[model samples]
Target: MSSNLAGNQATERKRRIEKYFQPTPKDSLKQIAVALLAGGGIAVLLGLILLSSQSFLAVLLFIGGGYALVQGAIRKARYKAEYEKAEPKPSDREMDRTLALDLQQIEDRAMHRLGITADHLETGAASWDPVAALLADKMVERPKKRPLVLYGPKLSDFGIGEDGVWRFKLYEVLVICPTVHHLAIYHCSLDFLSGGLSMEDTEEYQYNHVVAVSTRTTPAPADLSLERLNTRDPEDDEVRFAKVLRRRLEVSVSNGQSIGVTVGITDEQDSSKQAVLQSSGIDEVIGSVRRVLRDHSRP
Candidate 1:
């Protein structure tokens, strides 16, 4: 029936996504060949020009082509070196182990901060489509590697305000990037009245850019000034949401990197509840991310 068809479609979509993430050695080799060939072609054209006319212009052309060929060779060598150093993709068992460890670490941190264990916390691999889609709209260029997103347990509570004018719902989404040494946390909420929309807002924060692993509760070390803030309002919620989460971590190339954290908040009825949840959620995620980064940095 319709349910089965929908299930089949979902399965096919996931299969395609997984296939896309698989490494393609053949395609990489082909790209290397193409770059080298293009460089060689430029060199051959310059040689022909020099044979016809041995002038200053011909020498300049020769030098340009030589530079291109050298660059191509360098790139090819880099590609080969990277391929050699690349580790094989983890097996299903290994992935499961990694996921479990990541979840357990986050859960431990959450329990310590919230003072209550999240028994109903759900865990799963976050879909890449949404992340990719957001990046496509927000970034001029995509990241070299698709970030591995693992959704940690969510903390949510609902209550009716004393005035009875609106009901308040507070929830925190803890999304961790286990593969990468940074985090971006978004906290969004909706305020509506009798099935009608009222208002929605989002805020973002970026964190640590040091090569050393350290814990600090300050504004993210990135260059987020008043001038960088957007002046116009966006029509689409997704567009606005993506904009709020578009900041990147300043990573150090030498001694690894520190955890990057971001926080977004949207409140409708009670500011106190929103602030408390937001602060606790941000603290929990930052601690969790720092723990993961420290473990990765250790030899």
Candidate 2:
């Protein structure tokens, strides 16, 4: 009785989670059987109706019906066997637990690759926000801790992708601390797409090596960072509605270290609301950079 109850529960759970999964072999086979059986029955019916003058056609239809019926029977039997056997264990999430765990390990490894030591970050004054961090650490340029700051392994957008496979572009962490005669920047820029971190080579450099700093705010299309990579299409109403405001603050080093961050506001129909919110966020972050530039303020 207990075994039967467990099997029924498992089946129920599988059915509930079906939306996240592809149709099973059993379900696929069953559907195929339904279609083929209907086709076969129709053929047999037409064959019987045409048996007099359409005798040859009737015979061919009979043969075709037999073939379809045979295939349908085979599929039905397979589906029955599968149903009787068992359903696959289901998860509430689309990705398996093991895959999720492995993906986390990949994130950790990727962070390490960028030369941001866990110990160094842990010892910093500010509590580490997984999305953004103003960190205190010894950098390659300074080779000491006190005078340096690392801004983040921050995401362009916060929140998961709707389809369980979202992408977030990791912004270039800024390095402008107070009282330091020259800034020492560490950049690990790239995209984290579809549960995998697709990152560039981590770079470290001094302020004097910087070639330019450019900043811009513009109307953005559907979020390229959070959504899957898609070519821009002709703007329909929905596409135009997805447009929000975005700001990019970029600094380029002499040796090809392009450090930048792109931040944007939530997409909503209220244009004024979006602008106000976006400007607030952009100003808060950009103000820190501006302060560092203006009078070497501690951030």
Candidate 3:
């Protein structure tokens, strides 16, 4: 009796869980209808071929009825299986797109308020593969005038992607300006840009350089530093961004020398910054950032 009671309880719990996760009747019906149409059509074709000698009208009706029954049953079983199986969450691409849209609005607002130049916008996932190094490798192939700005590796230091793939996802934006000095890549510092409404311990990264953009609103280095990455008003635009920070230590097998590009973002502005970084390579990126600062500081 106790065993039977325990089994009953287990079954009840399972039924409750099923009720929680199962798709609505409307969704189930849609899936079933689609499946039945597809399967029934195939069954009809097969039946006609197999019973070619039988009365055409009889075969037609028989096949139609048989197909409906079999297909409906199969679809119901398939739908149940689908409901039981774990479903995949939405992709990180959704988050990246949202972040991109928000950042663009922010840029527009900032540009309007500050009277600055607004550049092109681009967003995509940044993954740490040998492929990323190829981006670095390709940078060497550019013309002498076009320098490379190693923005740093994205998405290994703990950031979430659109699909909830927090382990290996990166959100990037690139802005292309005219000069080499304008190239700068800002990453989301997992710690700083995150947290409360205020941004702190801000960091700046340029071609082969890293500096704190601001420390609790305190000005740090003038060169390669940003006066303002934000538009200074929410009314100006929507702010959306994401970043991944990672440290890579490259050690030589021949010589014991090492250097690394630590990836991170300081603000939503980095998403806009990335667009510039991608367009003109490194030199142009640096130039753009400097120009924005110069214009922002002008009386």
Residue-level lDDT of model 2, residues 242-288, one tens digit each, is 44555666667687756665544434445543211111123433444
lDDT of 3 at 282: 33
Best by lDDT: 2
Per-residue lDDT of candidate 3, residues 1-299 (tens digit): 99898678656534532232222333656577677777676767666766756667647756785778677877777666655542332233433333334344333333333323423212112211122233342333332222122323232223233222222122232222222232223222221121111111112223233221211211223332222232212122222323311223221112332222333333333544321112123333334334444544456
Runs with alpha carbons beyond 4 Å of true place in candidate 2: 1-37, 41-57, 63-182, 189-199, 203-214, 217-247, 252-257, 261-284, 295-299
lDDT of 3: 0.34
TM-score of candidate 2 against the unseen true structure: 0.39
Minimal lDDT window, size 10, model 3: 191-200
Which has the greatest TM-score?
2
RMSD of each: 21.4, 12.2, 20.0
lDDT (Cα, tens digit) per residue for candidate 1, span 1-299: 99898678656533432322233344466487567759766775877767666766666767777776777777777666644433243333333233334334443443344333233222122223222322232212213322222231111222211221111122222333333333332222211111111222222222333343233323322443222322111121221211111222222224353333223222222222221111122333334445655655566
TM-score of every candidate: 0.25, 0.39, 0.23
For candidate 1, list the clashing residue pairs, or say none.
none
What lDDT does the true structure give each of the candidates? 0.34, 0.44, 0.34
Distance from true position, residue 151, model 2, in Å? Answer: 12
Residue 13 alpha-carbon offset, candidate 3, angstroms: 31
